[model samples]
Target: MADKMLQGKVAVVGAGAKNLGGLISRTLGADGASIVVHYHSASTKTPADETVRAVEASGGKAFAMQGDLTKVEHVVKLFDETIKRYGRLDIAVNTVGKVLKKPFIETTEKDYDEMFAINAKAAYFFIQEAGKRMNEGGKIITILTSLLAAFTGLYSTYAGSKASVEHFTRAAAKEFGPRGISVTSVAPGPMDTPFFYPAESPEAVAYHKSQSMNGKLTDISDIVPIVKFLATDGWWITGQTIFANGGYTTR
Candidate 1:
């Protein structure tokens, strides 16, 4: 087994069913931190079960917790449950987001509202609630999108949502600095996950691949190290979003 990087620590990962969240859960769990697998209804699947099993097998601890991050009460309840079970929250990594794939002309007010509710609003409230309950030296990592910088057309709403989270991450970091809580965001490029392939067009996918220095989608394996570093070893790092793209647009 690997060294216990975060032995006896507790981490709550929002949207930790599969893909990025699952990977984050497993990575932290493997490092010796107990995990809270928070998932939304749409993400309900065996991924949660599988993640819990994987964590336990790796000499870590984990439990599955479901809640709608869009609601403030749910966010409070989630932290409450985590503290009740694990005693205190040492880390929190939020990987939940609302992605709207509609064209600009097709976008509506409802779409804007829903997107913010999930991406910005929920994240905002989650940080608010979690920040209040977190102990000193706690870590908070939020997952945003590199699209905020690229602004690839046809994703106005999606970009806006991610941009908001990026801003929130920075602002929260500054606010939580005095408390010894570090807030950071992970802005990843196109990753080889269900969230990327199903929603993107062939042309778009090819275009993104061509933009990369390696000409490929971001691998979940490659992302694990960045997450692990920020979640555990990055005590001095805060208020910055680390881009985990495979040389996709240096900007």
Candidate 2:
């Protein structure tokens, strides 16, 4: 691949300050893209700030923007900040998500609503607002989950949230195809992040590991390259969910 495959591009990675989001931001920055690192909270500096540091360290340009993605106004503000700082918006990777774990019966309306607000509704508007500012050949990628297909117990709301994102990718791709913007989702299973620590329980941990073909956990680093690929190289592909789950799905 060319060293500058993403040169001169501007990207916004929401929730970019910690864990997988931070890693994805750094990887894209390393590939020569200028970045807008978006975080949700104000109390603490987000992982996106650290991402900016890493990007500058690697000789790329980046700055930090903060907003609540759950609200349309804030989502719009995120992009506005990006454009104000960078002059253009080219790629928006929606990596903001939360999982509310409980059995379907125990799940509350509030849980469903909150998950949808952050995981689904946020991405939809993020793309909408960013799309308005994005130039030709722009890209939008969202982090999805194999759980939507696996539909395991204890994640009814979570799975529904991700399933919404998967379908949104398809719809957005079609809606934006004429303008040359690509929309896609990358779904992974059993990733090694702070999000997966319930696996510390011996029985549940064993079961989770067993689901992988290799009986191992997928590292955050393992997923960054694929996220980078979908954001840049796989331009012709859109509306599809590429599962990066260590062979967690064979069908």
Candidate 3:
């Protein structure tokens, strides 16, 4: 088998300033990969800087960049800057996503467009750009949601938009396979992040927790190792969505 260790590899982590993204950056850095940490909002700059510091502390080179990845230009610049700074790209992991839990009837056209833009469009371009710029044998992963497997409602837009990424993963994997690039998506269950609370009510949160093992939500810690695995040891897995939702939902 090809060596799967991350040592000497270069990685670009989208939305990598905080939460799950931050942890993934730090973990990969600890494993000896240079990092390009991408954050979106101005508010995320501090976290991005902190993540870069953490990577550097781990003896891996790293720097922070900001971009609204829903824009293709920004996505292009993100990979371009990674190449400029590091000279090569071996892994790209996109943790960019948006969540909305509204009834189908209540979802506006604007909401649908925005959700698809952030969840689907951004992911597509990220993969496309990574495939264009990465070295042979690179790995690409996108963060998705476990809701894609649930027989539920109230998240029509959020889940539907994320659902599109599964197909993108498959197509990209096929097209990029000949180049030795592996493409995959990860669907983590309802995680305990600020990102999960805004759209959830108390009771709904409780219900989500009840469905998972230990009657608790997924943690950022729980998911990062899975991502790290994909980027390294799990390189054999491609063209599929691995649900790491603590048994909360599955196909």
Please report the candidate that would top lDDT against the real structure.
Answer: 3
**Candidate that beats the other on TM-score, 1 or 3, i.e. the better one:** 3
Better of 2 and 3 by TM-score: 3
**Candidate 3 per-residue C-alpha lDDT over 59-160 given as tens digits, one digit per residue, 9 for 90 to 100:** 888999999999999999999999998899999999999999898999999999999999999999999999999888899999999999999989998999
Global fold similarity of model 3 (TM-score): 0.98
Ten residues in sequence with the least summed lDDT for candidate 2: 1-10
* Candidate 3 weakest lDDT stretch, 10 residues: 1-10
Best by TM-score: 3
Error of 2 at 206 (Å): 1.8
Clashing residue pairs, backbone N/CA/C < 3 A, model 1: none
Alpha-carbon runs more than 4 Å astray in model 2: 1-4, 43-46, 198-200
Task: List TM-scores for all candidates, in order.
Answer: 0.94, 0.93, 0.98
Tens digits of per-residue lDDT, candidate 2, 48-104, equal 667789999999998887888898998888888888888998888888988776878
Model 2 TM-score relative to the real fold: 0.93
